[model samples]
Every structure is written in structure tokens, then in C-alpha cells.
Target chain A: MKRAASRLAALSLALLAGTPAALPARAQDAPPATRPSDDQAEVLAKVEKYLELAKSGTAAVRPQAARRLAQLGEPARARLVELAGADGAGLAELGPQVVEIAADFGDAGLRAALWRVLADADFPWRGSAARALAKAPVADEGAAFRGLGADHLWQVRFAALDALRALDLRDARAAVRALLVDQEGAVRRAAAALLVDWGEPGALRWLVEELRREDAYFRVPLGAQARFDAHKRLTELLGDDFGFRPGESPATPANAAALARLEAAARERAGDAWPSELPPIARAAGASTGDVLGLELRSCRAGEFYLRWNDADEVHVGTGNAAVVTLAPGTVERLRAGIERRVAELGDTRFWGEAGCDLEQYRCVGADGELRTWLLSKGQASEGDLRPAPLDAVAELLLLTLPDEASADPRLDRLRSRARAALSVLGGAL
Target chain B: MISLRSLLPALLLVGLGAAAPSAEDATVVQMVELNNVEYQIGDDLPDWVIALDGQRIEIAGFMRTGTLEGETWFDLTNDSCGCGTSKLQHFVRVTLESGTTSFTPDELTLTGTFAAGEQEDEDGFVESIYRLTITSL
Candidate 1:
């Protein structure tokens, strides 16, 4: 439980240091001289045995105890909950250790107990329960998130918000939007950032206004620069220079003038309904609702370049010549779907094996407003003859971007067909 | 090239100066220092690195072979697992003076002479930013 508390505090983004001992658990409220009866002693012994088996057992043996505990149903649930509510000294240290195992139980009765703890106004374990739920696959995800978000504690609320962000639940959009005015600065920041990521309509305006506030100052460290986090996100959403330079003070006369100019530009752009002529980054950040994608290629052997489709339906591939070609009608939507499918294949794994001389990189801006990059390399492992090879489809796409005279060789015809087959899943005459 | 024996006399005459390090003293160059963002992006290695050109130094990193055969002269990188994006200065060339030693997957600690420059092939792609002639491994 202590470790869970510390992890929650660190992930809160509230700029607060957590001391494990300072936070009291439910055991602190109980009378000191109370002794366990025979039934309670048996329950405690069984809980300890199950915890030990879960911790030290191998993959084959571990699931047996975990399953048995889950099958024990209500009795196991009650004992584990009591242990989790224990103080953070000696044996109580086991409280944090048993959370993942207990979650693996995935029993309805146990899950109900956890939900009760989460919803309980008197329980001091709400933060711990919310955090465990964030990692666990709960059945009533939407309802659990809603309840946790409304908790009185800021830490619990922040954890719930983070869970909502990771799940990217479209159904909970209204609830998430309500958190934009949260009392804690960290919660408000997280809410605004998640809204921007989902391409919500009013998110950009809220972010800009946050930066323009009189109390706004750089309180968080971002890379080499010390600008307000809102300002940084705004720059990422809009262009790098979004109408004004970030000066040292928000109250300075020069800064105020610059901000006025920025606000004027924003208001004018918003009035136009955000035409597609704006930058691709701006369009991805919800400035406009048309199709604009970023494509980048980097190689140790063939060199590096970026490609993007402009508002005029022209694709610019920077292949030494800055080559521009017009795409056929309906090709843009097909391309967007193609990119989305490719990104889904690269979820948690970006690159595999060691670096090789022949390395190729492919990047794309997905239709869902997220940027994805993948690396394909030819690598030989330490002891094996088996070597890793680059993706053939991506290599063919790369060849298409190069100059026609060099890439138009007849030998590439087979590969080109394969590449088109992979990229053109929508299947028309592009 | 100035021999290690010849640089010693010059160091004694110059006498323990902070600006110029003698060849006898082993300098340690961190990967973070070599990849400093302050350096200008260009074909040539910056002048600031030239101070440690001929000096012996010790560096620790992961080993990677240039070809499938796994030769003795390999590229050492900041990340052994090859998990993230890489830049030019993230690798240093290490050549074994005593010929091919067995390649090991573990992180290797090496002592060698540090050489700073940009070497390109006939196609003019940057081959390296730093090179080391191994004295010990």
C-alpha cells in the first residue's frame, strides 16, 4: 500500500514529494489492544499462505493459488482487503505486494469489494483502490472511472483522470471536460491535455486562455526551455511560433502586446472555421477537420526526408528535388486508413534487435491525430546466423519516394505490386 | 603522429597545465558530453573536441558490428538494446590494434586513443565522428 501511494503521488504531476510514513492507513484508527479470534486467525493464516505462494511460485504454479484464492470468494476478499488497509510497517508491507495478485483474481465478488472500498466515504484506501483499478481490467470501467473522478481526494481524482486518458473512452468525454475547472492545477492540466489529444473542439481555446492568464508562469521543467506547460502544448498544437515569442514574464508590456496579437489571430482563425490552408500540425490539433498527414523517411544507407499532403491535394516528398505529385481524388481517405492500419501493427514495439548499417525509418501522422514512427533494420544477433530484415512493403514505399530515373528499374515491379497491395487495403484505382 | 614517449617530455616542460592534458594521463569521455546539443550541425567535428584528439581515454559502451561477419573493428553506441532514435554522435568507432578479438554481447570497457573527425566514403555519407585505437579491453 505504501508503494502504491508513492506511485500515485509521483504520477499525479502535482509537483509534490510523497512521504510514505506520513500518510496514515485505516489501521491507525483501530484500538491498539484488540486481539484476533479463532476464525480471524485462520483467515489471516490462509491469506499469508496464499500471498507467499503467489510471490514465489513459478508461472505454472502461481496461477493455481491465484485461482484458488479467487474461488474462495468472499472470505479471501475480506481478509485481503483488511491486509491492504493495514499500516505500512513490517508485515503490512505485504499489502502493496499482494495488489497485483489479488487483481488477477478477477472475481465478481472481489471486484465488488474493491468497488465498495473505492466508493466508501470512510475508507482511507480510495487512492490505492483507484490506482489498482487503473492497472486492472475492471468490468464496470466507465462507472468506476466516474465514481473515482468525483472522489474528495485530489490524488484519487488524478489517478482516475489518468485512467480515462489511457483508455481513451469517448463515452466519458463530458465527465472529462468537467475536470478542466478542477481545483488542483495538475488535474486541470491533465484534463486539458487529454482533450487536445482527442481532438476535442474547445480544447485549443482553453489551452490558449490558460497561457494568457495573469497568474500563468513556468512551474514545470520542459526540456531545455522553462516556459509554461500550456504555452509548450499550444506551440506543439499550433505552429512553433504561434503569433508570439515566449518572453520571461507574462506581465511584461512587450509580452502583453504579443499576447494581444496572438489572441487577435486566434479569434480571426476561429471565425473562418479553420480552413484547410493552415499548417498540417494545426489541422491535426483540431484547428481544422480535413485530411493532413505527415510522412517521414530516414535511413543510414539511403538518407533522410519527410513527406506531407498539402491542402491543394499535392504530396511533397523531399527527395533532394523536393518532388511534388498530385494524388488522385479519394486517394487521401484511402491513405489515411492505410496509415491507421500500419500504426496499429506497431503498438508497443518500435524497433527490434541491434543497430545495423542498413537501417530504414518510416513515420506517419495517423488520422486519429497521433504521430507514429517505426524503424526497420538488418541486424545479426550475438550468436545466431538468423538476421533481422526490414519490412518489404515499407522499403517499396521508400523507393516510390526516390527519383524516378533511379527507382524505375524493371526489377522493382514485383515489390511495387506487393507494396501497393499492402498499403491500398481500400482497393480502388489509385 | 606524436609518439607516447615524445609527448611525455613536452608535458614535463609545459608542467601540469589545466588547459593541455598530457598523453600519460587517461581522460574519460562520457557519451552525454560527446553528444552535447551545443555543438553546431555540420560535416566536421567541432573544434572543442580537438583538445582530446591524441590523448588516451577510457569509454564504456555496447558493441555493434558493421557487417554480418562480425569483424573486430565495431561501432560502440550509447544504447546496447537499439531501442530508441539515434543520432551521429551516439556511436564511436573502436578498432583493435592487435587484430580480431572475440566479440562478446556484454557491455565492454575499453582503453584507447581518442580520434575526432568526420570520415566519409566515396558516396559522401558520414562514416564516423569519433574513432579509437584499442590499447586494452
Candidate 2:
């Protein structure tokens, strides 16, 4: 029994480090006396190769390396745990990978290490650690997991809920129930789904209402994606799709019929337990609604920038780091006219040159409420002679709207320089 | 002797006349159709997805990046941010036949030849179940 416990611990540790810990399950099912001896030299060589790959391989290669390393059992687990416990640079270099791999084991030491990592507010891999804890839940840590449910980051809160679900403690139900009111739509959906999974009545109403979401971020269909996720969850919990197609508009006759059938099914299942008239689905924070024009620039290395202007002449800028600033007015009309003229000048040529790391996307809502999109390669103007004047002008205007505090950001400066260089090449003024 | 350079102008004119592929020539595949399924290692791909193998296809997705430097190959995923647990089925491995490209956080529309099924690497790891080969960007 002690040996089995140790093996479980090792498995949890491996999982925490993001390594495949299934090898330990095989070991646990069989007696140690009948275990086969792996060739020492072969094991050592394989460990070295996988460790190197896990450390520096391409994104696609790293997960595979972690799996292969975990298959080596004790040697790989020991090495990962040691690396995870390292101080300073050594820990920083391999902390995420080690924590992911160590999650598979139920070893007290591994659990303690993960707990420490989870508690560290400054740790970059706290989310990973939180997820690892979920995979190998300890009854004693229910309070800790519950505490994480209230974390500021929705990702952490979601991870905490997952851990509580895995732990299956009776008291954690209220904690999970409270998150249904979470500000983030994703988290609210997750909380509702979890409650439904625990056989709580009336939670199904939340997902049903979510199907009508039409919220967007310019051209990105965030609400549709959310609706799809909700439908997927509903289908899984109910074991029926009810002929619902997420791609179709919710108001379509076919979709309305399908949703009616789903609602009937839910009502039948819930019997007298279903709640009457659930609260309306809330739009995600900062989602665009009735915006006249939106422009976004995504830099491969630098990050993402979003600018949205409404008919109210309100210009909102999102730095993609959760930082949003409202700029002073009076520039919206000039910017809109400039963009419209430029768009007219560059007709039907949406794409230019080859694909690059940076992308510029423009979205505008027409009088008929139709959304039109123009996607362009941000590096194309500099790479080739095909000058996209609209993209350059928009970039310049977006930079110009930055408040005094955001002007010092290096990313904005790089964008400003690029926009100026392109305008200078075109002999155009902003 | 006829020089190939002499034929370039006519070729360019012909290319300009038919620069973009017609809609009917390529099937538009969405990432949700591919990703919204439960799949495990060694599980056979669904028949509907298998039907897309070797077909000319257009897909829009975000490029999953490990580094900012250019690469000849990259993974295309439905999720812009790596928030959820990624599996082999969650992404399609895309290889360029010509020049390399770097990571782009914005959505990209790519036209390519699609291949489906498990492809294992030299070390016996399943690299990806879906693959795409494009002649250009």
C-alpha cells in the first residue's frame, strides 16, 4: 500500500510538470517484484535527449519531449522535481515544465512544491500549477483551492473550480455555485456548467440563454464562440444535440425550432425544479456594440492594439494588456473621412505581398448594419511597392489618439515610426 | 533560341487575369468543425474530416508560435490565446513549400492541400493528425 501511494505521488508530480505520467499507472497496477528492468544506458541516453528537447525544442516538439521523458519513470521525475525546486535562474528557466511534469505525482514533496508555486503571486506558472493541482487533488487542500476560486484572474478562478470539481468535496458546492455570478462570461458559463455537472437544478437555463449571444470584438465573433461552447457543454451534459446548429443565427426559424425542442427537453428533465425566467445573459466587458468603425493592429512580437470609434465620437483604445483608455474627442470625423477615402482608393485588393508576423484588420459597420472587414499584411507596404494608404493612415491616427501617459510605450513608438515611414514613402500627410 | 525571359510578360498577364482561385475550386473549412470533437491518440479521425484529405482547402486560424523568428512550418489553431489545454487534435501542422513566415497573432486565411491522419515523428511521438502544405503564404 505504501509503495502504491508512492507511485501515485510520483505520477502526480510528473503530471504537474506537464509530462505524461501514464507510465506510473502501469507500474501501480503491477507488483514491483514483477517489474521489468530497463537498460540503464538506454534510459540515460533517452532522458538526456528528451530533456534537451523539452528545454529548447519548437512549440510542437516540447510537449512530445515531456511525454517521452515521463515514460522514463523515476529518473525523469527525479530530475524534474530537482529542477523545479531550484533557486533563482535555474528555477525560472525550467519551472513551468517541471511544475507541469511534477503534477502527475501525489508525492507529498511534489504537492508541497506545487502549493508553494501556486501561492506565489509573482510566479509566471501559477496557472499551470493550479491546473496540476486539479489533476491530483488532495482533500486537505480544499480550502486552498476554494481560496483560488476567488482569485482576480479568471483563468486562476477557472482552474480553482476545476480543482474543486476533481476534489469532489461536499462543502465546495457553494463555492462553485457562487462563481455563476462571475463577471467574465466565460467563467460564468464554466461555473454554470460545473453546477449542472454536479446535478444542480436550474443551471441549464444559463446555457440556454447564452445561445442568443451576438456580441463581437469588431469582426471577431466572440459571442458566437461563447454560444458554441455553451452548446457543446449542454450537449455533453444532456447527451443530445436537439438538432441545434451553432453556425446558424439564433433567430433563424430552424434554430428557434431546435432551441424550442431543447428547452422542452430541459423542462421535462428538470420537472418542477426549473427556475422561472432566468436572468439575461450579460455581455462580456469591453465587447463592441454598435461601433461605427474599428481598427486593430497585431504585432507578432510587440502585442495587439485595438481602436474603436462610435457615432457618439467616443474613441476607445485597448492596449490588449487589459488597459483601456478613452481619448479626447473631435478627431473621429476626420479619421472616418480619411479612412473612407483611402478605402475607396484601394478597391478589391484586400491582401498584399506574402504573409508576415504583423497583421492589420479594419472593420466598419454600414448603414444597413452589415459588417465589412479588410485584412492586410502589416509588413507588406514596406516589403513591396504596393502602398496601402488606409492602413498607414489608420496606424498614424491610432497613435495620435494615445493619451499622454501611453505615448511613452515602446510598442506605440514602433508603430508610430512604421506609420510615418510608410506615409513619407507615399508623400502623404496625416 | 527562345529565351524564357521573353515569355515572362505573357505569363504575368495570364497570372494577373486569374490571380485568386475561384471559390468553387477550394472548400472553405472552419477551425470549429475540426476542433469541436473529442479525440484521443490513435483514435481514427471521423469520416467527415477524413473526406477532406487531399482536397484543396481554405482555412482561417491563428498561427501558434514558439519563437518570433521565421519558420518553414507552424501550427494553426482555432484559439488566438493559448488559454486551454492544447492537444494534437487542437491544431493542424502547416508547412510552406517556399519562403518562411513568422508568427502572426491576427487571424490568417490560408489556402493549401490538406492531409489527415496520425503522423509520428522519429521518436514515436504523434506530431499532428491534420497537416497542410501550401505552395505560397
Candidate 3:
């Protein structure tokens, strides 16, 4: 996998270098005209200045830099593409802004570089590349867009739909329709909105139904955001909100009435074409029982870990792949009660620390079957002293449940030691 | 029993009382409210959001950073992927008043005094429309 990724990265660099064979056929296929020496020096200075600003300035300033680079025309763009090639690993960090700059240029060479990034499976910014590709003219991109629409990551698939919409490729209707049942709720909503724009009135049912969704990752209200996005899209496209307020709890009587009115309006719009049954609401994959509690720590560079315990005295633990082990009788009940008490004392805060690339996510199914979630930065727990008290205690308890034989596994042993150290700092026994 | 070490910060804040805002005093704000509006550089922010200026607020979001070490400031964004059009309104530029924070991959809750309005840099580029100043992690 590493070798394959390296080769793809190299190929992307080659494309950016404007190798003759790598160039796509377009009316503006010629390389950007070279500037006079003094003008070249001036452009180079401007590029250096903007690139430095993009690196040091506020994150919002990166877009401004991208605009300035776009205004500098092709020499600056060639320099950026060269910089991207020299530091392939930094591409993930710089890809979004660089791609945005490329999107503004009418240069075919720049678009070709985007295609290479989009095609490389290991590229971290494929979604950004896909969205950027939308601004440039499309030529044999239908197959590529369709393939990206089926990418494993919902973000990539979502961006592909957006690209198709921007390109106004009405011929891709079948491809968009297939995504109405996408596994991710947000993607499904995006697909529905796109199809509705294509004059498919029946697709309005998906948006109407999404307004009533209450799916959550613990207490995060992910579904609420999805509903909000759907509502916003519907309002922008149709200019009528039907009184559906996304901030209100979906289960509230007021939202229920609003949803009914929205559904009626959708049905009227669909006329005889409304489906007899709506597609099932998409949900994240996991155990949904009220008796289950799961913690997932995901670090893209370091790998991922998951621990799940339930009422049946079963504990599932894994890094990458999971193993289920039955715990000692009555252990689950005791641990669950203790953890519940600690969580309650932690209060209503749903997330801790500022966002980063790594995550420490805790999800527990409450007695009422509502999933309550808490999120903390994984780095916050890297040190024993800084680990959140409630999370440390819960993690320690869960670690203790591992049988003595678990120590035989190196990964499990490391986790156990880490939890032990954290608990000790809190003056708790494991 | 809760650890005294973990409770020290809250205890110290209580001991100080009205001298500063406690964690409990921070109004919990949702990222949705800040990002719901599509804002350009020169456009006026919604009145509801502008009302939050200088108020102690707590908000949750993912941090965007190029590095994980010795960072005194970072951008907090609602979406992790940062796909679609990234306008000036999409991020809240957070500056720590004292110590720096390392980057973490999980969702974070930050409590601080918020300033809402467009602020430009030397180049006339809008740096951020919303800003936050926090004392510590």
C-alpha cells in the first residue's frame, strides 16, 4: 500500500510538471507564456510573499492568498505546482488552498494536476480536489465523477455530487438518483437535494423526512446538523421553509406538525410520482442497544482503537480488528453503574478541547435508548495528568476488565499501562 | 470521589468569584448558529451573532492547524473535511491568552470571550469575522 501511494504521489507530481504525455486535450493546451525577466522576478517575489502569508496568516487568509496566486496567472501557479511536488507530504496541509487557486485558473495543466490528486486513493484531499474540478470545464470527467460518487468516504462522494451539480451535467441523473440511498445521512440529503434541482419532484420526500431525523452520536446531534443542511438547501431551492425549524428537537410536537405540513407540500409537488415507501434513514454503523457503551479513539497517523461493553457481560476490544470476550458475571452491571455516576457528575458538556485530527469519542446508550456522546481531544488524554477525570476513571475500569491473558497482546498491554498510569494520577484503583 | 487536583481550577475560580467569569457563566453557543449564514468579507454579520460579541461563550468544534506543537492560536471549524466554499465566516480564529495548546483530533469545547465582526490584516485581506480569546485550555 505504501509503495502504491508513493507511485501515485510521484505521478501527480509529474502531471503538475506539465509533462507532454500527462496533459489533457483542451483548447488552452499550450503552456502559459513566459514573462519578461524583470516581470518574472516580480511575479516570483509576489508568489513567495503570498505563500508565506498563507503559511503564517490566519486560516481564513489562505483563501485570500489563493486568490492572489490566481490573479498572478500561470507562472505563480507553476511555482505552486512545483512546491506541491517538492513536498508531497505537505500536500494534505496545502491541498485545499492550492486546489482553490487551481479552480480559479482556466489552465488545463492545473486541472490535470487536480485529476491526478482526485485519482490517487491515498491522497488525503480528494474531496477538495473533486470540488475544485467543478470550476474548470469538464471533458471526459463523467466516469471519474461517477467513480468518485461511490468513494468509501462520504465527504468525497458528497463533493462529487456537488461537482456534478456545478457542471450541470443533466446526463448524470441516474448517478445522482442512485446516491439517494447513500449510507451516510448527509450524502443522502445532498443527493436528494441535487435530484430535486434536476426537476425530480419525488426526491423532495427525502428532504422532508430528513427534517424529522433525530439520529445522534451520543449527544452530538449530528442528525440536527443534517436536518439543518437539508432545510437550508430546501429553503434556498424552493424559497419555502414550511415552518420547519432545525434547532428544535425533532420529536417535539411543533416539529412533528411542521414535518406533516412539509410532507404534504412535498406530496403535492410529487403528485402521482411520490414513492409508496420512503427510503430507510441512513445511520452510522454500531450497536444501538440501550445497554451498550462504546469508546473509539481514532488517530489517522497512529491507527484506531475501539472498546465496547454491554448489558450481556460482553466486552469487545480491538485496534483495526475487534475481538469479543465475555466478562465475569455481574461485572458489567457494576462497571456500568460506576461509569454512569461519573458521567452524570461531568454534566451536560458534550465535547472537550479544540478539534484536532485525532479523536477520543465516548458513546453510551442511556436507559431511555438515547445515545449520549462525549468527545475529547485524543492529545488531552496523552498525559496522565491532563486526562479528563471522568474518561480516565471509565477507561481504567474498562481496562481492568481485560483478562490476564490480554497482557499477551502488545497493543492491549500498552493501552492497559496507559490507563493504569492515568487512574493512578487520579488516586483511583484499577 | 472526584480528584482534588482535577477540581482545583473550578475551586480557584469560585474562590475568586466575580473577579472573572467561571466556566458555568459561559453561554454555550452552537457552531451551527455562527456558520449558518454565508458571509462575505464586507457583509454585516447577523444581529443575533453580533450580540455575542465580548460575551463569555463556550462552543464546540474541530481545530484546524498545520502543526500540533506550541500553538498559541488555531482555527475552529464546524466541519472537519472543510469541503465546499470556505468563506470568511466558516472559521472562528481562537487566540489563547496565556499558554499554548497542542492540536488534538477530537471535537473540542472552548470557553472564552468572543468578538464578532470583520477584522482585516495589513494586506486588506479579512483575517477573521469572528475571534475568541481564551485564558487556558
Candidate 4:
């Protein structure tokens, strides 16, 4: 009976995070400690247990538990963020879960928790946490983010730049201004994006610069053997937060024309930059050598780190040119940027707004389309694969993901054989 | 060599020609319904994505199945692709419904048309996600 009651209490707490949790304190009312709200205690107790379990579950029962606690609402936010960011923390492992819980918390708790997350060492997690706080449910939520303008982790601090978009309070101008000069192109872009909205003094120039880097560094080629996090999208981008809603009106004619113009302009712009598309660093290697690629700052490769999006100028396997690519100096940096951008765009509430999908877990799918059994989790991407392969086709395939037992794994063998066989056939045709 | 520069003109020509000899502007696709079977992300990975079931779905141009969900539905029609190349058709996934009543399936393919946005406004990053007729199992 007690367990059932506790479970019910936890469930209620989860629901409270979404709807209002009756924050009835008329300034004269007593605090929880004095009154002993039975509900808060039950939730706290259950949530603590959930956090502990979140550490050991095999297929991720614990992560789900943390999510449930998140649903319980505001009171649990402090606990959730604390545990999710524990020292020697596995931010990547706990990233998706932390974001999930953060999204579930109320503005009061979220605003504070998101602040701490902004300075976290982990880029992926910080980015996720920042994006969550961007659309925070309350006003003046920018305080925590303001200090993050100079966080140590590049991605984490970068996320702080992104957080400014929705949380751009008048007082937060200093933070946004500082980020505008950030070394990372993504940081500058986010800072500029917010400046555009805020109409800050001299932000467009910075935005343009960031945009320049975005286009130039966007599609730098992958080296012969480059492996990045292929499981980020699986955890962060995937999920059921299907952004569609009912009762949406039809698109206006003007809207159609505008979208077309954007498409055409993007094409023209990408084409113009085809010659020097990538940064010089990315161009130093194999198939990625001197490809006329353009860039767009979005997520790819499982939303892990960004990929300097390099393109083959519309090279199609069947279009006679099996595969050709070019790269520049910052191709790898651009790739990393893509990952960062993708991580931030997931739940902006600005573009898709209320329509973003509810993020769940991450997964890994191969070229032939198979969800990798393990190594798909967000945590795995952060610290697991430290060895970088040489640049090459086999390298490209390997980068899609690294099999646990490269020799014994059927997925790796299948990918290797198919890629080799395909390349061989293509090479023969060439 | 046919560069993307050259290809765009050709693609534009095709687009303009496809507008018909009726001396008028051009046309388009959207996802409306499904029933009885499971939702498949794409032909290659035939698995149901439950979140998209029944609920109206909207997505970007190119989509790969990931465990995380937000904008879970991305239509791979011409302009929607992030790749800006032949869509791997790989950027595909579908939500399934069980028998007309609920969405539950082993595998289902998404077939839909998107409301192409106009290309003229300053704040015109607008693309409205529309109805997807569910083909449930």
C-alpha cells in the first residue's frame, strides 16, 4: 500500500511539472519545511530512489526513472541536476536524461538548474541543457545563463549563447555581447541570432562573420577515417516530440514565395562558395580533399560532434561520379559545429515552437539501416572512442560507428564488406 | 562537368516545365492518413515510430531515425532535404496506428505532401506542418 502510494505521489509530481503544481504561497504562507507537505516528501523520497537506480539499470531503466521524477515537477529539479552533474560525471551518458528532466521542471527550478548546466564541462549535455532553458517557462530566467557566457566547456558555453535566444533579458546583453566574440563560430552565430532579435547595438556584423564561417566551414569533408558520435540524434534528435499540431491554418501565398526565395538564395550562395567551401585543415586529406562543399550549421552524424558538412557538388553514385569531395582547413571544426548546432535546434520553440518532439533515448543505425545493439547511447559518444582512424573510405564507414568487437561484430563486417564491394564496383566503372 | 551551378538551372527548368503548358504557376504533397499496419522509418529500416501515430506530424527534409524526438517527422520531398542532394530516402520514418483505432505496427512507410512555403518574406523561415492521414494496422 505504501509503495503504491509513493508511486502515485511520484506520478503526481511528474504531472505537476507540466501543468502548474499549485505554487500557492501568498507571501504570508509557510514554507514546506514548516508545514510538512506530505506530497513533497513522498515525491522527494521516490525521486531519490529513482536517481540511484538511474545509475545501474541495464537497458536504461534508471534513466527512465529520472524522467519519471522529472515529471513529478519543480521540487525535484535541484536533485535531478545535482545528480546528473555529479563530479567525474558522465555528462554524455546523463545528457539526454538531464535534458528530459530539465524540460519537465518548472521555471523556478529550471532557471536555477540550467544555470549550473551552462558551465558544465560536457559540450553535448551543456548544449542540451541550454536549449531546454532557452524556452524556460518564466521571465528573468536569464540570470543563470548570463554567467555562462564564458563557461569552460566550448559546447557548454556555446549553448549559453544559444540560450540567449529565448532567454535574452534586457540585463543579459553583456552575456550576449561577450559571446559574440567567442572563438567558436557556433557561439558567434547564436550570439548574433539573439542580437538580431534583441536589436543590440552592433550585432549584425558579428552575425555575418559567424554566417560566413557557417557557410564556409559547413561542409568540409571527412578525412579518410573519421569517427564521430553517431548516436546523438538517436538520443537527442529522435523521440516522439513530433512537432505537428492540429488546427494549423494553411500557408499563405507570400509564405510559399518566401520559402522558395530562401531555397534559391541558399543554392546560389552555396554554389558561389563551392571553390573555397571548406576550411583549409579539412582539405588536407583523402576523398575529402578539395571538394567544392558548402556549409549549413545543423546536426548530422547522430548529433554527436558537428561534421564540417562537405559536399560533392551534387555528386550522385549513379550520376556518373561515384564519390568526390573537397575540404578546407576547418572541416573537422565545422563538423563539430554541425553537431553543436543540431544539438541546440532540437526544441527551439521558435521555429517549430510548440511542435518539437519529446526527446527520448538515442540509437545507432548503420548504412544498411540497422539499429546498433550497443554504443548508441549519448554517454558512449563523449568518452568511449578515443582513437581516431586515418582518413579513407573504410575510415568513413568506420566513423559511422565503431563496433565493440570490430573483428567479431557482424555489423562492422557487413559495413566493411559492402563498402569495399561497392567502392570496388564503382572504382571499376571509373 | 555539370556543376551544382549548372544543375540548378536544369532543375529550375524542370520545375518550371512541370508547371504544365496551362500558362500558370506550379504545384505539389502532404501526409494525411494510414491504417492497420506498422509505421516504418523507411524501407531499409522497417520499424514503427509510435509518436507519429494518429497525431498530425511534421518534419524537416532529410531525417534519419534517432532515439531522440522533436520534429520527428521530416518529409524528404525535393526542397526539404538537409543534404541538398538526392535524399538517401534514408531520411525517412513513419508513425503507425493499430486498426483505425490506435497506432501500433511492425513497420510502416510514410507517404505525404508538404506545404511548400513562399520565398519572399524577411521572417519567412515558415513551413507549416499539416495533416497526415494514418494508414493503421
DockQ-derived CAPRI band for the predicted complex in model 3: incorrect
Candidate 4 lDDT, A313-358, residue by residue in tens = 2211101011222334554344433433442333322111111111
Q: Write the per-residue lDDT of candidate 3 for residues A1-430, one digit (tens) a residue.
A: 4333333333333444557576444312534432234555566667667767654455677778877877887656565555555334444556466665665656565577777776676565565676677655476787778777877556678778877887787898988988877655677888888888888988887777677665444334556676788888878766788777676665678677877777787888889878787643332233223336776654423334556777888765541123456888888878877778878978766555443334556666666766566665433124333346787777767778865444544335555555444334332333
- Candidate 3 vs 4: which has more DockQ: 3
Please give the DockQ score of every candidate, comma-separated: 0.03, 0.08, 0.16, 0.05
Judged by TM-score relative to the true structure, which candidate is superior, 2 or 3?
Answer: 2
User: Tens-digit lDDT track for model 2 on A183-302?
Assistant: 456777788888887788578877776776665666456666777888988898778978877755677797889889997887777778778765422323334555777766554323
Candidate 1 local lDDT, residue A412:
25
- The interface root-mean-square deviations, each candidate in sequence, come to 20.1, 8.0, 7.0, 17.8
Candidate structures ordered by TM-score, highest first: 2, 3, 4, 1
Ranking by DockQ: 3, 2, 4, 1
Q: Considering summed lDDT, which 10 consecutive residues are worst modelled in model 2 chain B?
A: B13-22
Best by TM-score: 2
lDDT, residue B137, model 1: 51
By TM-score, how accurate is candidate 3?
Answer: 0.65
